[model samples]
Target chain A: MTGYIEKKHTFRSWVIEKLFMGKTIKEYLKGLITPFNFVAALILLVGVPVSVYRFTQGIGPSTNLSDNNPWGLWIGFDVLAGVALAAGGFVMGTAVYLFGLKEYHPTVRPAVLTGFLGYFFVVVGLCFDLGRPWRLPYPMFVSVGVTSVLLLVGWHVALYLATQFVEFCPALFEWLGLKNFRKWVIKLTVGATIFGAILSTLHQSALGALFLLTPGKLHPLWYSSFLPVFFLISAIVAGISMVIFESMLSHRVFGNRINHQGVDFDKLTLGLGKAAAIGLFAYFALKWVGVAHDNRWDLLNTPLGHWFLVEVFIFVFFPCLLFTWAVRKSNAALVRFASIITVIGIIINRINVAIVGLNWNLEDRYFPHWMEFAVTITIITVGVLTFRWIVNRMPVLYEHPEYKEIDQ
Target chain B: MEISRRKFLKSISAASGASLVSKSQFAHGAERFTGWPERFGILTDITRCVGCRSCEAACNEINKLPAPKIPFEDQSVFEKIRRTDAQIYTVVNRYPNPKPGGPAVYVKKQCMHCDEPACASACLVKAFKKTQEGPVIYNKDVCIGCRYCMTACPFYVPAYEYDEPFKPEVKKCTMCFERISKDGIPACVEACPMEAMTFGKRSDLIRVARKRVIEQPDIYIDHIYGEHEIGGTSWLYISGVPFEKIGFRMDLGTTPYAELTKGFLGAVPLVLILWPAFLIGVYMFTRRRQEMVETEAENFEIEEDQQ
Candidate 1:
């Protein structure tokens, strides 16, 4: 009995030290009562009950989706936009491991963690939109529809999620003090990154291909045969912009954790901005090419045509110009601003494709219910809380001192 | 009795062996599926259709759907157009006559049951199937309720049970599969007072529709609406007025919707095969370059030390 008690005592102290930062339970609870936590709690308090109401009730009451407009805000903002923004994982991985740009090695962990969390929450958000959420695995294990574009998406997301988890496992193993496991996972990094790039290329373009069947339904101005190419290029821009946007916020929130010696983050930001600028320019020229290809110039005088122009020129072209100026002038703050605009532009483009431009000729329009908005906000908050929790406990933003010499 | 039974079994085996040989001979040279040659279809004569709702009533009764708030006999339902829903599988809309002084034309709308169904191509779970019997059937048992079928259908035929909290299904016209599989006509066709719908083999129905248009060119339009639209729907139609002036959209081209996504799906395997090989090549080049740069820097430092 004494030996067992002593072992238990040692384990308890280790947990308190590692998980709680050597603070008592009371002090740890007190530390979590910040303004941000309080606001997040308030949002959850309203959002959770709303989510429960949605599951118990039917979709008709919870959302504004109809037969004419089957998809709504959940699919547009969560599944489509979420997957596009989460491209940072493969982007950063391929840049560092495959292309041998070792200067980007520091941003890899945070970017992959954000991507894993982003895709994880996208599936969570999809659960609310699916009529039979429990059968989500049916497409994979039960009956595979090989001809479907969605099947490609389903398989890629599942496989890529596993790949990303493997890529981020070194951080997790280091946090748990499993030195042997960390070494094994670090060795698998290049293979996992190559696999991740292949999966990302297929699925990101496949998401755009999902709309190819609806050329008659989607507005002519937005519909083009080059949709898959457009989507792939825009995803690269979104991935790079998200890295810049996320890094800006991470530095402000967790500044002390960064090892500032010899690592110039501002210079990295400028490099990413230059890449994003080039991507946006390509996307902009392609958008006009799409218009010319379809001969939709006559539509520019109409209401929806003007909206498309705003989406292209203001959101896409303006950001391209801003990013170009920022990179040339070496203005990190300006690059951050351009990234925010570009992020918003990606969101707009996705929503326009999935919801707004779809069924444009129809009489009835879909507007999401208040409860739907509540559910979306709740899912995002939970994701943020989980990210913060993991970043606090794991070696994500900083390297563990014991594993300092081991390069992943 | 034992001898007679053995002889019967021998004859049955002999017949089965002959059929198996013939089946292989027929399959020798065919590479592409030209669809079921003997599949049944319906010929819908729009001019003969009255505004009466007997077909709708019969469809609801045969499907055992919940009753509508407004009874089937009410004429006020024609004031606004209606579409197929969870409770109703078919609807008829009245359009103003194109000649200005004639009676209103009533058009019945339902699933076209195309030869190549877009829903079957779009379903990730293989929930939708295009059977050889000429009906695009849905298997709710495997559906994950993604609603992509609703998005893919060119005719907007599929509807969902959004009100059912659990076990919601995509509902559409089954083409009376239970009846038609047993060599019986669909409920709506049997219930038509004017015999507006004629049921026969798809090829025979097309021949009959062509004869009608060729015989009376002025009474019928020069074109059969569904004869070539979206890869030739099983439910063929012949109308007096232009199809576009009525509810039919002339803009949906003759190409099969499934063919639109074929290029993308075909590229998936190519990427799966080639992307890894190309990425590894890039990685090799990058590693070699990095090593060369490191050696160059080391040589420079050694020369500086000697100097």
Candidate 2:
């Protein structure tokens, strides 16, 4: 209202205009009750109650995690996979603000938003899984396990979540029409971005470092001294692929706003696909080197070895080739397909390290109980709803009119 | 998604540039960690063991843990291999004897209480500690029941009390800490009628184990099991049969499990220090490039106005 010539609206009118999309509240709720939203609603309806049950009854009743298998779906998907997927913030922040890639400027905000929401929801999932999650900050404040890799993860994630929030504060400021706060936050962006990158580097690798102590338990195929490096490299692949996958979905779902914003989705997809191809290729090569270094050649004859090969060939190498082909041919459809594969491949890798490859010789392998899946689905649903709610009104999908042409 | 070959090339360079910037430590590392000097430990001779469950009973009674389903005198319980669980800190597992028509050799299984315990290193809150007294003890008050110790332990000694819904703590043998700290023997050692186990300084015990092997090389397999396994566990065993044949993991090399993450953890400070400088340097470099482009555009516009 102050920066633009438009008049200010009362709170009720503003809500009606922005949230209700100038339609009646009844109409807005009717529009929201689509098949997808109905499914999302059902998931949360069952899942939230299951989460409550977990807190009261403990993980024994809710999860299939045993002493033989201490971690299950929640830790693997929510913490490990969630953190890896959220690497987009650091990747895009560096590309746009640090590396002088001005063309990717349109993606930086959304990438950071995606990263912020991903991490926020990861913490939500951790609360459900952690026994006595209220003591989560004990590692940071109360006591210290200086030798542990998990302490590193705990501290880094907490600090990085704050750093990512600060990095995205400019969007929140603009959405709120706080001119001075927005300007100050824009100035803080570079420092916040740098700190976010630093935090990401430590924790991303630290996640893999967590499994280093479980030498014989985690299958030798996935276990190597190179675990931290492999995790870091593959997280880059996850970040790039997720940005592609996310933008594809967001552009289609928020069609009119994206069209109005003039985001060239095709160009961004090809550019991200090219970068992912190179990153995935180097990571693929790293995996082979890891196998050779560990001298696990004979392991390939076994079933576990064949499973490892499937992960490498079909998921890792296949996507690498497809992305390369997609980039070379400028085939957006193939690029999109490869992006999905790359996303799934990253999830597979995290699951491999966290669960499947772990305790490989156990007589009874652990599986996630239905309650565990329900809680996980609930967290994702809430995260998506939050993302949609914010993106609808914030300057994330569209540039702030007053702040236009101000390069971040 | 539009990119000229130049920007595409720039991004290829960027991808490499990003990889170069992270600078991960992925080197293979294997190092032995001999624990504290003068730490008390156990030296058990497997040949003297008669599959007696006296040690198991002593451990359970000393720890005040719940009673086992089968009494300690019930030898039928040993028919199948058993693992130490929440209520039972130690178990006697029967293995095939080296000679024909002989009593199966029994290996007393409990926490190896490794010199550098992986569980202690893995706990996020310092809930577990390798005490100078030679036992790896856990703090019930500090434990958040993450159960990571169970996962990191190569021996799988730490068993979680999953049934304890309110506050669960890992259950494992504490090496009879209460008794040992008082200059008294562990309950198991006291309970052994055959005197199969010896308790003394770990260094002295190792020498004693070595002497037994040297004196009776034929009877002793010539290798002190825990004296070398995983950088020498507290509970040493000199067995007449090969250790592996008696459920011991001969595959566990002398390298301590804690050494596995040494290189990775060593690089933590390096990342914390190097990353911010790298990030800021890139930011300044990019900002300068943007300014240069803008200045050049302004100059061209001025030149056009003059024309």
Each model's backbone clash number: 0, 4
Residues A268-386, candidate 1, lDDT per residue (tens digit)? Answer: 99999999999999999999999999998999999989999999999999999999999999999999999999999999999999888998888888888898899999999999999
- What residue pairs clash in candidate 1, if any at all? none
lDDT of 2 by residue, A212-251 (tens): 8887788999998889889998998899899988888987
Model 2 scores what on Cα lDDT? 0.86
- For the predicted complex of model 2, DockQ is 0.48
Model 1 ranges with Cα > 4 A deviation: B1-33, B304-307
Q: Which structure among the candidates has the greatest lDDT?
A: 1
Per-model TM-score, in order, reads 0.95, 0.92
Model 2 residue pairs with clashes: A266-B1, A267-B1, A267-B2, A268-B1
Candidate 2: which stretches are off by over 4 Å?
A1-9, A14-24, A259-262, B1-33
lDDT of 1 at B135: 84
* Candidate with maximal TM-score: 1
